[model samples]
Target: MQKESVIKVEHITKTFGLTKALTDVSLEIGYGEIRGLIGENGSGKSTLASMIVGTGHPDSGEMWYRGEKHNPKNMLESKEKKINILIQENGTINGLTVAENMFLGKESTFSKSGNVNKRRLIEEGSKALARIGAGHINAADRIEKLSFEDRKLVEVAVAMYNEPEVLFVDETTTALSQKGRELIYKLMDEMREAGKTIVFISHDMAELERMCDSISVLRDGHFVGTLQKEEITQDTLKRMMIGRELTGDYYRGDYEMSYQEEVVLEVDNVTWGETVQDISFQLHKGEILGLGGLTECGMHELCKIIFGAIKPDSGSVHLTDGTKITSPSSAIKSKIAYMPKDRDLESLFLATSIKDNIVMASMDKIKKGFFIPPRAEKELADEHAGKLEVKMQNTSQYVRELSGGNKQKVVVAKWMANGSEILLMDCPTRGIDIGVKAAIYRLMEQLKKEGKSIIMVSEEMPELLGMSDRIIVMKDGKQTGEFERSEVLSEHDLIHAML
Candidate 1:
């Protein structure tokens, strides 16, 4: 039997100002196949996908759809042909109702003689929601009332409502719960059965292996290779993505450092609504305590409470010497630093220079008398930037220009430079590449050696198992299980505890 190509991208090259984003990239996605696009940050994976959707233009190359050359001038043109892209970030309007956002452009279709048919619009939106297994969401409810995971579901519903023949989902699963992810996977299966093609990008290797029919890898703006299902393994994929033989587990480390007997931080009888109840945990000096659970398990909210971003309904945080830190400002004053899950939202000043962003955390260190010293600031920024191996032409460059992985490194550099004793990290390696992740693990170890304590919240099981001195699994808003480093916890064990 002859296979039909749904998307054929040939000799694509894209340049942005002075940077070559993609070079001579060629790929063929067959009809009904879910193609996994795997690559490190800045490796041209997103660039190629953008070119396909017409969000970007290839400097030189052609894309063919159904035996005809297709050059879509914009996303609207691509959408007209039933090609849709779900970006990594949420694109919903928080102030609008779910139904209004879903049928945004085609609202005129729901009008009869210039009168809007509200009932019909809600009915159609409800049907779309049911198809995506998100029927629980009210069509008329404002998007701001929804959780992050539910908002992600709404975005998926919007894409599915268009009935796209070719779908591009880029890092959309990171925000979803296990059930939500299952719904997405089921929808992908149905779409494939209906002869649709999908280009799926994810940082989770397990999901990619389970869902993708074939996988193509890119490295440093060039296509490395493509492999079929049988040829794809975690190690093989890592090697291809990094262009080297990767040794040891990405999370491999022996955290032999012991913490001080004195407690560095303690949460006692914490209660935050019904989601979190009577939660208590203690972190020691120089120790890494990991929190793991499903998206709605309250781990994220708990971190926010401790960091003073959210005021706890009850409970108190006491420091090592029995001193209390009440708010985020006090936490900062007391030498505690927090890195939130969404780097784009909570960390990094996109419009600011890399040097300024890094120095923002250590303004006290750079200030001499009543004025800030430029030389001292540059020296501090350059020192940490070199240590973190942030790739940039100059520290004066804005953080927005750096790749995702490098930008994350800058976040770490900022906190480390500030001499923070206790660090609270939430999904520190969310969207970065394997190489950068390994570097982060190494940095964590270095912090431990420097007698710094860390409380980390992460969704990646392997990372939790690899780097923690102890693991705490939360369910709803309470602690369900605790594991010592020697417990050798399996993925299944953690998943069971989480659910």
Candidate 2:
């Protein structure tokens, strides 16, 4: 028996300025189904999800939910209809208490005489957290106090708090660790059992295969095809995503990478409050040094120390020529680049144009008497954006409008424009699809060939083994094991070190 269609989108079209994000896309999501949506960056998966979740509206066409017109006026209206979204980024505001963050926009029940009952809000928030298997988080604690991974859990809790009939999970697992991801998967399964619909968007193909019943492919905002569980395969999906045969080399070619004798950057006895304890590492010229660790193992903190984004308590980071990196400005001036994990919040100015973002690091170089030449800035930005193959209508498009993968390309473009000698990349491929991931891997290899040093901090072990000249494994904020890349190095060995 065919399951009933719970939500239906008919010939929906959406445009961002001149960029056609979606065109004549049509689909129907069945009740109790986990529908997987896959595409490269800028492929319209998130755009479609956002439209359905009432974050935005399509420029043309109509959608229906439960056989009724479903043009939601606002997020609150969508939730009232039992439709909810878990957005890709951390949506909660900082400085607010966890309870306040969770119950934002819906305080009517907790309100009395124009006053919010703070205790009742906290109690309900605590229950929600516990229900989502995130009881570790304190409802009364400030949202900013939670770690990035924990905050993601809170986002999930908020989305599920209303017991939504149709849930949209948008590239969320990429931000979570194994346990957190497992908890979400468990919830999805339970929701399916309860006859709820899930519109799942993910770059993790493996997870999608395991969790989704029907898989849909979108390429450049057009609905290509939808495959059932038995019909879905990685190669088939990849082909649909790029509209071509994908070359096998997603990482650097299998070769023995030789490191230069010269150390480009040195983190000598760097120490930070509990996060990093007496960490020391050398980023050699032309070497791709990999930092592998579990979530919150302090690799992120160490990257910030190297970039001079955070001050180390007792040690110094320096170029081999003896220039100190005591601040981000000094590091950038010294031809050092840092790509943060949080691309949207940390790496990008969302409201600004792509050209502006690309030219940000090269402001001094493009300046004409303390002012930048508009033409030169645009030309330089265009060159880098083209090199990265960022899919957009124009360089003037706001970065906030681009997809997850394209935004990452912009981040890389910024550093490339600066022509940095040493690059600090943390989770460079996080929340991105295979095509963009391949491009970044190729770029990293090319940079190494150009004699530039790269310090790659990642939780993805395959990427570490695939691209690194030497891998440093961390556990509990300390280096556990170091391995020079070799075919004989087992993943089990790396996992042991991370644990």
Candidate 3:
């Protein structure tokens, strides 16, 4: 039986400059339910969510909430009207404590005689954190001092604490560990039981199938259709989103692969503060090594250390020829490429043009006596953009305006154009759709064929199982088990090792 409708969006048409994000899109979300929103990058999932959450208003559309006109000017107003959203990005202020951030824009209850009561604030934040299974984190600690995953937990706790009528979750689980994810899953179930509405946005199809009561698909800024819980399946959802049947194995199909015996890079006795402890690993030529563990297992930080972005306190990373990498510049100069987790800040200059971004890493190769000809740069950028099949208006378009998948493509194409042989990637397919994930896997296969090695750190178990030749599990700064990827290997095994 269908639940009562809580939100009715009618013929929404939204445009950003020349980009039509949504065209005549319409859907209904009901009370006491979880609805999944999915599509390829640039398919207008985030835009629609933003409209519903008051981040942005649709250029043309009318919405009704509980049979009343729903028009909100800002997020604060939306929150006042019993609506909340857990945005994809870290929405907390770096300088503020968790307690302060949790109560931001609504500190009146804690204000006593025009002065905020810090003690009561911390007490409330602690309860919130504990409710979300994050009791280890202190609410009084500054946001900047927390780990990225922990900060994400704080965001989830704050967003769920309000008991809003409607909640929006956007690409939040990609960075989270399994434990963190379980907490969210629990809250989602609790919210549904309490008759609250949730609009979930994610690129993970399996997660969507498991969590969503109904799934809505969009393609090219147009509404395709919605699927009931019983109708949601892998191929069916893919067909709906892509407008056709998708062919080819999602990951590399080859199991009996050959790798070079020569080790291309080595990490010896690596120790960094309390995060990494006596860690060591070796990467061979043409090998795809997978790292699997909880978000706090130190693999993410280890990637930075391997790439020389962060130096270990007492150890070394050495290349095949015994070249020590102490910094990112040295690693880059030595033909090593690192794709960081935070793509917007660490990987690309968002304000720069696509042409400039593509050629930025390969500037040393394109310079003509201290000057790179614009024509030459454009040709190079266009060649790689074509090679990666990056969707764009032109090479001169700003990269920030592109969707998440395209931005990732730009990052990869830029590094590939640098002619690097070693790739260090952290959550390379974190929030991108399946099509883009397949493309990245294909690219990795091509790179492996060309004798390049990759050390991939990711949280998605299916991806690691599908793509890696070998998987290493870490737990609390220690290696617990290592296994060769085979038909018998299962997520249960990985989870057992990880926990």
Among the numbered candidates, top TM-score falls to: 2
| lDDT agreement with native, every candidate | 0.86, 0.90, 0.88
Query: How do the residues 292-377 of candidate 2 rate in per-residue lDDT, one tens digit apiece?
Result: 99988999989998989999888899988899999899999999999999888799999999999999999988898987899999
Model 1: per-residue Cα lDDT at residue 438: 88
TM-score of each: 0.92, 0.97, 0.92
Q: Candidate 2 vs candidate 3: which has greater TM-score? A: 2
Error of 1 at 443 (Å): 0.8
> Stretches of candidate 2 above 4 Å error?
1-3
lDDT of 1 by residue, 334-442 (tens): 8989998877668889899999989898888779788999999999999999999997877898897777788899999899889899999999888787889889998
lDDT of 3 by residue, 1-499 (tens): 1237899899999987777899999889999999999999989999888887888899898988888888889888888878988866667887899999888977889998999999999999999999888999999999889977788889888887887899888888877767777788888999999999899989877789999999999999999999999999989999998988996477888765457898999999999988888888889999999998988898999999998989899989999789999999999998999999978768889899999999998989999999989999999999999999998888888997788899999999998889999999899997899889889999999999999999999887888888887888888887888888688889999999998
Instruction: State the RMSD for candidate 3.
Output: 2.6
Better of 1 and 2 by lDDT: 2
- Candidate 3: which stretches are off by over 4 Å? 1-3, 107-109, 112-114, 368-378, 485-496
Model 3 residue 404 distance off true place after TM-score fit, in angstroms: 2.3
